[model samples]
Structures are given as structure tokens and as C-alpha cells.
Target: MKWGENVKKEIGQKIKELRLAKELTLKDLSEKADLSIGFLSQVERGMASLTVASLEKIAQVLEVDLAFFFTLPQKHEANIMRSYGQEVFSVEESKYFYRLASDLEGKSLEPVLIHLLPNQGREEISPYSHQGEEFVYVLEGILTVFMGDEEYKLNPGDSMHIFSSLPHEWANFTKKLVKVLCVRTPGIFQGDKG
Candidate 1:
């Protein structure tokens, strides 16, 4: 399967599982998410494209952070996560780049390095929603954050604590590169907690 399609199917499955685990019927979820049942069914079946906004609504209704959908079950043995040899990865739906900073399986905290290229816009980024808290520190250049329609700009050495339940997006609408260190909770969903 193609990366985008595969990822969509994975996310669809996760959504379905969460909804069922919560004992919510399709109609219940559709109403709570303010989405049509047919549309939600199509998404769960991986037969439709899911926009970030729509996903945020569903995630909010499902009571899971956006990271829960993107995370695959991986068991990591090493506790020390070195920058060297760490592969740069990304969600296909979003143009932003990412590097996993904390890889210990089942850890309470998940740290990530986010890189936004120059001139990137909200359309190129994915919206995020979760029930966790996030701490972000600007490492390089300027980072533009949109938290539930509130816009904020952060420069080097600037930091912010974000309530993850709010739908959020990040952009770098400048000529310079942007890098940020982000740490959040409720990650590593299927592993033994630390």
C-alpha cells in the first residue's frame, strides 16, 4: 500500500477501535463529532479522505489525542535516544518534518523535534488535538502556532505550554528555517507505562 493510503487505513482502524472500545455506536460518534454518519462510516472504512479539521473533531469526541492515531505500536529497548542515526520522519498528510526525540517504549512523555520549512502554511500542516499537555520550546528561527484559531509567534528561546485538547496547527511563514522541541503526554499508547 502507498504510504498515504496505508496511513489512512491505519488511522481509520484506530478510530474504529477507539469508538467501539468506548461503547459508542456510529450514530453516537457522528452526532458528537458533528459529522454525518455516512461520512464517518466511509472514513472508518478507509474509503474517504479525512481532513485535519474533521479528524480533530472526531479525536475530540473519541477522547484521544491526535498522536494516538499516528502512533504505531513499537517496542523500543534502548532508553538513550541519540540524535545521530535517528531517522527523520513525517506524516504524509503534513509537510512538517519530525524526529522522535524520546523513543523508550511505554514512556509517559514523548519528545519530538519538529522542523518547518520556510514559507510553509497551515494548509501544509496537520491539525492536532489530544487530551494531554504539551511543552514546546523554539530552538531555531520563528515558529507560528495556531491553537484553536489563536495565533502566536515564537522565536529562539521562547517556550509555551499547550493544552493538547485544542485543535492546533503550526506554520513557518518566513524565509528562515524553523525548528522546535516539543514534549507531550499520553504517547506510546500500547506499551507498559514508565
Candidate 2:
């Protein structure tokens, strides 16, 4: 299977496992998530992909962090260095690829290298919001960020910081590829304390 498909399958399995552990049936979860039963069932079976907004809704309904679906089961190191050709994953149908840049478990920050292809943008997907803060530094090409009612065009060497609670989305309008370094606070991938 492709990377996107494999990742989706794994995430779907995790969601199903968590739901069962919480003693919630598919119908129950669908009701809480404000999604249809058929859609939820398809997601659980890995036959469908979900956007970050949809995943956030399901995460809220399941009482789990949104990052729970992204973390791997392997141990993370305190001092980490990933060489070239490191693993990268897609954010469902977003057409963006990201590779985790930090390995400090439970750390306050999560850094990722995000690659946005030309003409591929988040406008097709719903914007998502979460608790914390985010800093994005454009490494190459240009990035168009949509936050609430405003839009910001960022070029290489430009950066923006914002509270993540606001609805946000991004896209690359340039013909060239866009690479950004994004750092977020509150460790979204950290294990649940609850």
C-alpha cells in the first residue's frame, strides 16, 4: 500500500481500538462526532480518509488528543537526528507531506518539516483548530496561509506565529514547491495523561 493509505489504515485501527476501549459503538461515536454512521464505519475500516477538521471532531468525541493518530509505537530519543530520506507522511488528502523533526517525548514543542507541492492547497479541506501555539517559517518558495478572515503570503526567510485555537489553512500558489518548518507548542503527539 502507499504511504498515505498505510498511515490511514493504522490511524483507523487506532481509532477503532480507542473507541472499543471506551465502550463506544460505531453509532455512539458517530453521534458524538456529529458524523454519519456510514462515514464513521468507512473510516474505521480504513476505506475512507479524513481531513484534520474531521479528525479533530472525532478526537474530541473520543476524548483523545488529535496527535494520538500520528504517533508511532517505537521509542523516541531525547537527542535525535534524522538523516536525509527520513520517513514522511501525508495529512490525508491535503496534498502536503510532513516529517517529524523532534523526538523529545512529552516535550512542550513539536517541530515538523512540511512540504507543499505546487497548486496543492488546504482550501479544499476544512480548516482545523486546536489548543496551543504555532510558528511557521518558510524555508523555500512561497506559502499562502489563511487564518480566520485574513490571508498572509509568506516567502522564504519569512515566519509567522499565532495561537493555534484560531481556524487556519494553507496552500502553495506558486509553481515551485514550498517547504516550511513548523513548530507547535504543547506537544500534540505526547501520550495522554488522562
Pick the lDDT winner: 2
Give the CA lDDT, 0 to 100, for residue 122 in model 1. Answer: 51
- What is the per-residue lDDT of model 2 for residues 47-120, given as tens digits with 9 covering 90 to 100? 89887678878888888787778854343454564555356666656455454654656477777787877866
TM-score of each: 0.63, 0.79
Model 1 lDDT tens row, 8-102: 78888999999999999999999998889998898898877665567767877887655677754343436755555455544433344444644
How many clashes in each structure?
A: 1, 0
TM-score of 2: 0.79
For candidate 2, the lDDT comes to: 0.76
**Whole-model Cα lDDT of every candidate shown, in order:** 0.71, 0.76
lDDT of the structure predicted as candidate 1: 0.71
Q: Which parts of model 1 have CA positions greater than 4 angstroms off? A: 1-3, 13-26, 36-42, 45-77, 84-92, 95-106, 117-130, 147-149, 163-168, 174-177, 188-194
